[model samples]
Target: MPRAKRKRASSENSTEPAAKAGDKEVEKTVTSGAITPKNKSAQKTGEPEEYAHWLLKSEPESRMDKGIDMKFGIEDLKSQPNQTACWDGVRNYQARNFMRKMKTGQKAFFYHSNCKEPGVAGVVEIVKEAYTDHTQFDPKNPHYDSSSSRDNPRWFMVDVQFVRMLNRFIPLAELKQIHLKHKASGGPLKNMALFTRARLSVQPLTQEEFDFIVSLEDVKA
Candidate 1:
């Protein structure tokens, strides 16, 4: 069983839980990476989703038992034959649209949520831009949507290749503390989508914010 985690009120600066982490509820979404993401290379890719840095969530142990946080986590990406895989199974329109903005060679943080420890675990590169999520067309698939069609793809996905893990794991607890420390001055994470949209499977991150978080790992190292 997953351990019960401690909770803290969101930063005093914000009230809505649209982004960020740390709440009483176990933030749940169909963002689990247990299922395989459909790879539709033949499908048409989309224009940019209008964002820069991103953080994508997955359950490291979704596809197997007693996972070592590799199958769909940073380890999986790092260990893939070429350290690349398609990101799929996203049903939310906002998240899908986020993927649409991704471009080849961009980077995103591969976060592991709804697990023993939740936080930014590693980095991944966008190997391929957004493409139609074919999982929606399979009637037998859990992600199948009855309203979607080939003419209009309601969902999109991206291909990501592993980059490297942080020097240390930056747990959500530390992030919450950092949020409080900077709440008065509006720091890099002041408006980070992760804190406001805690449940959002995909959220944008500012380069500064990314650097700040990555820096923490370096500091810890």
Candidate 2:
């Protein structure tokens, strides 16, 4: 069974649940990836809906993951593993569009880069809509820039709320295993965009890819 996670108040800088209000819900949209809002909405409804998928990269060595932030003159973030952090620092235009296009409830694959066993680590959701990336305005921050004004922001970002952490690492080796097996049967292994384009930083996953990923058991003892 999936563990029940506690939703924290937004004021505490935690990820709040999606607003279910009909008026507030923005139309589901995907501006960058191949998936389109119209198709995704149809999928949401009874009309043969297609799944919209995306891949997000985070460096475990960096302060991106709240779980490993003890060395930053702060307490261990292990207790609050599901804390939602602002995903900023994206400079690429394609990446920024993906961030801007992300809609609430969109599923994302959290991949840990710059790590020994870099691969899909867990799942996350776009709980909040895209907004201006604040880091671009901060001069002290490495991601800061003098060109981006408040009125004309150069970057954008989305809020990702942690869903659940897989018990075991979904190693890249395992993904390769699946590919080889599929290829042997004359099946297409092209579903995984991550494998084809290593430096995309931001990419979409198809519904088929999303289902195959979730189907992997954690293999807990």
Candidate 3:
């Protein structure tokens, strides 16, 4: 399992509930952001549906995890068997819950984090929805949680299939400028989870924000 950078303020290994760990603010923000209009429509119609969009982060630089290299980028995902891999090792309760909300066939931006020029590099589709994360049960796994059990797993993961790289790599620096600009003018990305919850490895994106960001690929910075 790839080891995600501990950009989170709390210890990644902590299994306490988000409320107990003083994460109510983050949980509240993520909960609101994760609620896509599509989901509401599905609920109103009594039909199954997927989230509008999401963003997943992984470190591109080498980081050892129990003697295994933990570096995983968009290209690494593209080379996997069937160009798919389990998005495991997420320990944050807020992030884990977001994964659980994902439905198959949903799309997500593959963002490079903890690396030089970190930014959204590509897209991926959720091939499999939430399931128990096996790494949490393995003693040798860096993400192992002795508190979790097979019967009542504490972590979950989804399987994502590579879609395609963005036409242009959107750098984080450029995104920050856009975020700041939009925040002042009531633009689409003003409340984007990517900027509001910078430390979260997995974040939700409203349909408008997703589309707006994708449109940037063709625009000159």
Candidate 4:
């Protein structure tokens, strides 16, 4: 497989006030958005529900953002109070749109990026759906955008709680190889956004792709 040049993972800086532990906020109606999920009833039903999967990227190594360390890997999330933190600092409109579609209880792969062995290290569940990202309003924050405002916030974030780490780290190189094989074999991961839209910080995953990757942890390399 040809190695595609890896771009730096989209920078994330979350200085927003943390929400109280175990507080699940009410889902607000998305009045305007093209990607809003068609089946919102799943969010209301108090039963086991199928959720859309996602892959989120963050740098695990030390990187400075306005004097603040932007290194947030699965371990950083594990050590956080209540094992939950705001997924903020996403400035890309497309990525922000993807965040908007996230629902509470949905699972996502916590991918380590811009590091020596970038890959899916763990999983996280959305504890809170998309809300206004306060960092964009702070002038001192590295992600602060003057154009964004309190009334009509231009950026948004979701709160995720740490789940378990993968049984083994599945490096990006391995994933790329699988992607190429799947593409040639007409498999589920052929159109995985991680390759198709590699630059996006937040990428959507099909259920097949998510389950298939998680199943890989048990297979010996």
Candidate 5:
């Protein structure tokens, strides 16, 4: 049990927008932010609840932002247990292949990197998708993954729900000044993988950059 160099979770979160829950607007796109199908009358009843849109980073504190343990923000995923949780100790492999291309109910944007005043602090859905993150085969897990195996598992987890908690917290220096004034908007978000994968904790958003960062919490609520 040795090989450990994976320690980059707890990104950041603040929390406010929380009302959208149903009426499936059926949108699902990944393979690195590629989602377009949403017309045919909202995909004829949301094509079996297909969904896609993500950005997950947590760290309301997390042992002073990565000193160790804690690993959950947005008010600990709205006091988990049932608000749902298990975006386990990711052992990055491009953020575990973007959580194996999540696809339960899609929609995510709970950013909150490092601490103090990061950005985005709301939205979540992916109600269970990938699995097998048994704390990387716990040997007193700090995401123990001594070369994972139970027949070759490396690390994975997905199961978010807590939809809505925003009250006002979008910061990341005001979305990097709106990503330097729409860095040449070629369809918006001009290559915004959360500012070039800032430590990539499962990022991928392009429903027009997740509706322009959830429409800045609805024009600041």
Candidate 6:
């Protein structure tokens, strides 16, 4: 992706009080205007524009209503089977950060984990931006926490709508092959969140990689 343009700020008005790790201090920083390639001739000749993609991990059974049984519960399922749902239940800070970064319309890979066949099973679209995850406030909920107060909640979630299930499971091993191929082709999968141990759920995907993965379901199936 092209770096955003930066602009210099006048010294007289540049200083401002900034918060750092719980302390306030005066810091001088430059203000930059939105940056992008100024001239097409100077831009990379064959680069696709950046579009965000995400992978959302869920233990399908946990998400379903109690007493309902299925490979995955219907109540937990996206209403249209292609509709979006607020991806609540995340308790980790890093996962919350990724959710906060996601914008509406961003794509997500729905990965079913801790199940019989853990893999990318379907596609979803971000339908809502990050918001306080209400489940965290419910004292009876398993995700509830004494540390998370209404005034200073520590958890967040975003809405994701279902797209379509892959015709066949995109197995973990298959994803590895796709990841390697993407790396060789100089794509975003080279630095994918799925490859990072700390980020097992709610990951970003590039548009190119999204198309590539979906295409696999159509080949000679």
Sort order, TM-score high to low: 3, 4, 1, 2, 6, 5
Of the pair 4 and 5, which is ahead by lDDT? 4
Count of residue pairs whose backbone atoms collide, per candidate = 15, 2, 0, 0, 13, 8
Please state the error at residue 15 of candidate 5 in Å. Answer: 4.3
| TM-score of each model, in listed order | 0.72, 0.65, 0.80, 0.79, 0.33, 0.65
Score residue 118 of candidate 6 by CA lDDT.
57
lDDT of each: 0.63, 0.55, 0.73, 0.73, 0.63, 0.54
Q: What tens-digit string does per-residue lDDT give for candidate 5 at 1-221?
A: 11112233523333322212111221122232322375454356332223368888766654632245654666776775566776777655656656777888887988777667777888988877787777678776555767678898866778777799666778888787778778866546656767765656677676777887776776853
What tens digits encode model 4's per-residue C-alpha lDDT throughout 1-221? 11111112355323111222112231142222534245465345321233389998877888776777777778888877788888887766667767888989999999888777778999999899898887888887777789777998877888888899999999888988999999999887787877876766787888988999999999987
lDDT of 1 at 111: 80
User: Which of the two, 1 or 6, has more TM-score?
Assistant: 1
Please, what are the lDDT tens digits per residue for candidate 2 over residues 6-27?
2111010011111221111132
* Angstrom error at residue 33, model 2: 9.1
> What lDDT is reached at residue 137 by model 1?
94
Local accuracy of candidate 6 as per-residue lDDT tens digits, 1-221: 11111100000101111112111111111011111366342154332233387777665443233332222322255543345455666655545555777778777787766455556788777777888777678775555667788998767777666667778767666776666887788664665556643233555566766777778777652
Candidate 3: clashing pairs of residues: none
Compute the lDDT of residue 38 as modeled in candidate 6: 62
Location of the lowest summed lDDT over 10 successive residues in candidate 1: 1-10
Better-scoring candidate (TM-score), 2 or 4: 4
What RMSD does each model have against the real structure? Answer: 11.5, 11.0, 6.4, 10.5, 13.5, 13.4
